[model samples]
Target: MVVTNIAFIPARGGSKRLPRKNILPFLGKPIIGHTVLAALQTQLFDRVVVSTEDTEIAAVVSQWDVEVDQRSHALAGDSVSVVEVCLDFLDRTYKNRLPDTMVVLYATAPLRRAEDIQSVMNLLDEDCHFAMAVSVCHWPVHQVLKNHGDHVVPVFPELIHSKRSQWDRYYLDNGSTYAVHVDAFQREKTFYGHRLKIHEMPRARSIDIDTVEDFEWARYQAERMLL
Candidate 1:
């Protein structure tokens, strides 16, 4: 079998809201472990590399069969972009031999499916600059509030009249995972460029772990699915 040429999991250790969030226990395993296990289960990529600046994260990742690229503090700062970490890792380790494409798997997305990963990989093509897994949602974007100098006001007055939920267009950006060609990513440093594509995932698989409450809910969802 010819495995795809790219794969990477980025887990920085400086989350402020949820300290040590990467290694936090979820579904009887560390949060990062879930992403690692899912990526390994796909068996689609030629290589899987974990990028982190924390030695403890490195130690935990080392237990897996995947390679661990120790990131520097400069690149791992709270202000540094994910693109820098990715580009730095590739530049330092792989040198001129970067992969044809790469998948940026979020460690917080423990509910991500192996099929979701494979689905994005399957959708990759020369025309597509990037493809990311997304779940359609009906967020009340129009009902959102904006603060004026003294008073908060509705962002969209037209939505105040539109009472029906069906009228709203479907929204994206569940923030679970994104797949991009390494070459295109280097050009823009963003996934949603002119030629980006979407690989639709089920809403059940789009649970992103942002807060403690989200973590518990994800665990419950996983347990229910297991049963």
Candidate 2:
């Protein structure tokens, strides 16, 4: 049987750190525009939808000729979770007809490539319920320090003097892409499931823009990549 895949991007209007972050221009178009275009380029999704409450964002998405899943004000707040937004979109748009796979792409992840999106989606198969894009930690985990009341202390005191090879490597979610089985996502209400896979991405492509500094860094990285 053939399986249908849908790409969902959630970009709410209100951003405290950076105003209109979703529509902030990266290279030539808005940041979300990059994600939408990347999703379209993948050719893996049957439909690419941007879920947002901002009319300006909707207008940007319209320029790409993709469907815009208008989010309700209730689910489009600062405290709202991305999972909630995905569920709302699924309910409103595909009540009767649910896709086999759902790819959740963050609008702020401008450095995300189409190949990375396809890689994560490909990991979501019969046994796997979710597949997320993650990047290996740049710094040594043993050297990480935590702030105490009076002074800073190593997070792992036992590994403070240990070699980097002695410590287990850590990986962090890059927030670039999340691929989940639609039915499994609806049942769990989360991307984390029993059979979840991780698609390791390089640090250069793991930039998730939240603040102005992050945006600037992402811009630099994006421009450098193009050159």
Candidate 3:
């Protein structure tokens, strides 16, 4: 089916890495504000809904110019997979009136720019299983090492002997944005199913907020961008 309307944004309340990081105050508003603003800026989807079980978070989202898909408590646990959250949100919010497309935007991705969102949306097609934002990292895979029991092994052993980083280039899942067809998600819960599309964004714009340090870094980056 051809895709037009999309609705989905996973923002659970609990976070072991950085407790309540999703609703944490950023520069002037909650962390999710940036994501909501970016989503609105794109003006691509018919409706943008934030999926969460927390009333406070839902209240904050209501303050924004978008709808809220108040999630169930069981689905809000840390153990819940993002795919599960997205599926549930879609089922409950739209019922049988599912959209042709569904895009899942993570609230932790504060640095995801409005332009990048628009760029990824442009890549969405009926044939595409999924499409997401990706960015190239400065580090080489050869530099990564892993501890294997008693021995430290090269994360990518083959890359250890590689001459140039360019020849062994790798892209990181920026976690900034994702757009998927509704039918594709029903078939495969993952964004990268059988046929996935890639939309590259600037590495600086893909800063996913996780810790206090990450928040500070995002602030610094945002300030820098403003200047």
Candidate 4:
């Protein structure tokens, strides 16, 4: 049976770290524009929807020729989770016509490619409830440091003596893309479900723009990749 897929992008206006991050210009188009375009280019999703409370963001999404779901004021706060935005979009727009699968694309992930999005969706099987993009940890846990009062402490003090090769490799959520079975997502109300799969992405493509420095790096990387 052919499964229906919908792509949902949540972009709120209130960004404390980087103001107007969703609509911020990355290369030439806004940051969210790249995500919408990538989702559309995959041609795997039946519908591409942008959930935003900001009119400017909605307008930018409209320019991409995709549907926009006006997010509720209650769900527009910084504390509101991405899952909440997606659930709100489903309840408000697709109450009766729910899709078989949902792909949550991050607006700030300008370097996320269409192939990566497709790969994550393809990773989701009948038994799997969630598939997300992940990247190998840049540094071993033992090498990581934390600040505690006036002292600098190792994040994994117990493993400080352990060689990096001694420990199993670790992966971190890239926050670029996520795919979920709609029924499972609705029931669990989260991306993490019983059966989960991960699509490993290269660190270069896994850059999540949350600050001006990150955005600049992404822009430089995107330009280089384009060339």
TM-score of 3: 0.91
Local accuracy of candidate 1 as per-residue lDDT tens digits, 134-214: 887656666778999999988887676676654655658777778888877888878786677788876766788878888
Between candidates 1 and 3, name the one with more favorable TM-score.
3
Question: Which residue pairs clash within candidate 1?
Answer: none
Cα lDDT tens digits for candidate 3, 1-227: 43367646788888878889988887788889888988888888788888888888888888877888778899988688888888777666565556877777889988887888877777876666688899986676676898999989888776687777346557888887888877778778887777777888777677888888888888888888872
Indicate the residue-level lDDT of 11 in model 2.
92
Give the Å shift of residue 9 in candidate 2. 0.5
**Residue 155 lDDT (model 4):** 89
Model 3: weakest 10-residue lDDT segment is 1-10
Give me candidate 2's TM-score against the actual structure: 0.91
Number of clashing residue pairs, candidate 2: 0
**What total of clashing residue pairs does each candidate reach?**
0, 0, 0, 0
lDDT of 2 at 52: 83
Question: What is candidate 4's lDDT per residue for 74-161, written digit by digit as tens?
Answer: 8999788999888777777665657889999999998999999999999888789899999998777777899999988888888989
Report every candidate's CA lDDT: 0.80, 0.88, 0.80, 0.87
Candidate 3 lDDT at 189 equals 80
The TM-score between candidate 1 and the true structure equals: 0.90
Candidate 2's displacement at residue 172, Å, is 1.0
Q: Assess candidate 2 and give its lDDT.
A: 0.88
